[model samples]
Target: MSDSDPVKGKYAAFFRGCPVEAELLLSDIDSERIFDSIADALTETGYIVLPAALPLGISDALFTRIASFEDDVFRPAGVGRAAEFQLNPFVRNDEIRWLSSGDEVEAQYLAWMEKLRVGLNRRLFMGLFDYECHFARYMPGAFYKKHVDAFKGRTNRVLSTVFYLNPNWAVDDGGHLVMYEDSVEPIAKISPLMGTLVVFLSDRFPHEVTTASRLRYSIAGWFRVNTNLGPHIDPPQ
Candidate 1:
């Protein structure tokens, strides 16, 4: 889509807080050309949602490949009072093997990451970005409490991105992504649409994954800066 697209104008306002919901921007954007426009929107607001970023067929293929390794994945803990499932490819434990496993999914993830990095750099004037993919499966009643992606000793994470893989999700599905913006009240809720991509600032906002009525599949990850130092960078307040 061109910069002059009405969706672009709507997104500019949405990001600036003139519009409270993102559905306003989706009206004029073509799902097929979402990559570029969404990138532009993200540059100003630190977040963007492309209503239909992928086709059903491609989304299904990618989800199938991700599900094939369910048993080998390691789930996260300590974020909530109750058990909330999370799979991380960058975990420090031995239980989680082969970060990418050199599989077709890994290759696809790498390519997608490259494209995201290019878009981010072009729009936000940021460069040298890196990322890792993690699959999250939330079953009925499972939920992730509010938390920030970057913590007290880590700030290398520049942005966080999540691609929803579930199909036919509805408002009653209960798997919306809740984000707390600059205010203490009025949280933002994003629908978990198949092929929909959500990007946002990794350190500035606190977010959570709500309970699911059924199974919820998503590729949740972060983009970081490559540095000679380790993973203990100071967190941004």
Candidate 2:
């Protein structure tokens, strides 16, 4: 509200003195521009990166919440459908816990994602019906092998998203997401920096998480179409 408040909120250097209420910096995103960019990228290369997608306040709060959790709160991430799911550290060594509409910050983030889903659907006619996400933590020396988020003719996951929460990430941090646009080379190598958001076609991009020297945090999610019916569901995962 005050000029001083904005200055203090912007520089978050002294967390002990700055009030939490002052940190709720609402997003000032241009919806039309953002969705248009996303659509264009999807049409061209099948992915897009939106730096500082969420306001610094929301991203900071979400990161704090995830960092405050106990080690047991996250389970070793696995792959495949319900019964077919198995833990194979060689594939992905990170730990994860699905996000739910409980805490205030979590609710706000989910609502924002819903708005994104609706906006993209309207502009790009993506037919996105729902969104799901989980908080993931990769410990030191952990990594995920190159893989696609969705398989052809098998799942309803249409879009994949990754929002990074690690602050002050350095070039040597080693947790870069390398996405392959072609068979022989990568199109992008992204750092898991604070407030960064990456969205890509689930089945189009082949990506992998390189080893991290220190702990890394992020929220990985997907947008899906309604494929469930009376007696059967598309995917039980």
Candidate 3:
């Protein structure tokens, strides 16, 4: 079946930032169906949200596995600073520590992510050449400053997908995902909902993670194409 065969509609105005919000309104979208809808949505809105995309049990399992690696993650200071402010745990090679830990739970999580990649391409018309997954953990008071995922000479980062895993999260707990609307003054906030997938244009949106009162965990990464890339390359400066 094609993307048009499934549900289609404009999401709330809040989601329609300067870029786009292409949403699939299906009650139960299987992996293949989701892939198609996502691809179509990306073409128009530069992003899409898949609510309840995965089973709750599976989602819980994935988050549990991530929590197991709290110590193994290479936590680095200097994340949120104007030049360097907060702490960050970035796994660059995917061959050390947590990635190489080989715990059953971690293995299961990787397998599920691989399955997601296959589904995305088969269902959404995306090429699976340089796609990768990265896990993120934000402790209480931790925040990621606003920044674009794509850099000049490294435009292969076509899209960014974030799967929020914080269950029973409250507004007072903070750590909301904030995206500036059209590079304007007022910003839009998206609550971190369990099992909800947020996809958006990697190059266009300047976004950041607000400080959290409690621990916040999520699987955040980008979809990319193969290209020789450069480091910290500013857009025009």
Candidate 4:
């Protein structure tokens, strides 16, 4: 569409005049390009990792806020949902605190993810209906065994997204996210570096976190379709 087209012109004006959320998204052309790249990568492979995908300031603020949370605020990472949910440290040895719009960084990050959800839907026609995420901390020696985020036709979580929060991370840190294909060999090993974002098809790739020698921090999230089963819902609990 030409810039002079009335509909296109109206959107251009609206982009400039919209609120903070729109301003944060529409004003950053690079982010749009990044989203396109992410979509393309997911289509080509099952996953993609982008370094420095998020604004540095937002990543810093989120890391700081999560670090400040009281010890009790985080619960042992578990598998399953609601009644079936139970702590399974053998599978994953980490702690988690769910994300909410309770703080400035949390709110900003949610807004950012919302913008991403919209962008992905527009580009790929994924019908992503909602998103939910949590702040996760992996203490020394913590690790998660290989697993897929969702079961095909049993869950609505279609896409998984992870944002790392550890700056100055090293290869020795050992908390690399290892993704596997059909074979035993891993296809990708990703470091938990600050501002790095990873996106993937939830049920297509099996992945794990290697044991970390030091504290590891990240935001793990999913974009879900609105599929209902009886009175039960996706996201389980």
Clashes (N, CA, C under 3 Å) per candidate: 0, 0, 9, 0
lDDT of 1 at 120: 60
lDDT of each: 0.62, 0.82, 0.60, 0.84
TM-scores vs. true structure, each candidate: 0.68, 0.85, 0.67, 0.87
Candidate 2 — what's its lDDT?
0.82
Q: Candidate 4's residue-wise lDDT over 1-237, tens digit each?
A: 245433224345444444565445434788788888988997888788999887777888898998899889999999887688888889998999999764556766776787688789889999887888999999999999999998898788899999999989999989999999799999999999989999999999999999999999999999999787467655543
Model 1 C-alpha lDDT per residue in residues 41-124, reported as the tens digit of each score: 666676887766654544686678656666547454333112443453232111222235245444444444555565567666
User: Which candidate gets the maximum TM-score versus the true structure?
Assistant: 4
If ranked by TM-score, best first, what sequence of candidates would result? 4, 2, 1, 3
- Candidates ranked by lDDT: 4, 2, 1, 3
RMSD of each: 11.6, 7.4, 11.6, 5.3
Error of 3 at 22 (Å): 28
Please identify model 1 stretches exceeding 4 Å from their true place. Answer: 1-35, 69-74, 77-101, 151-153, 227-237
User: Which of 3 and 4 is ahead in TM-score?
Assistant: 4
The model with the greater lDDT, 1 or 4, is 4
Better of 1 and 2 by TM-score: 2
Model 4, global lDDT: 0.84
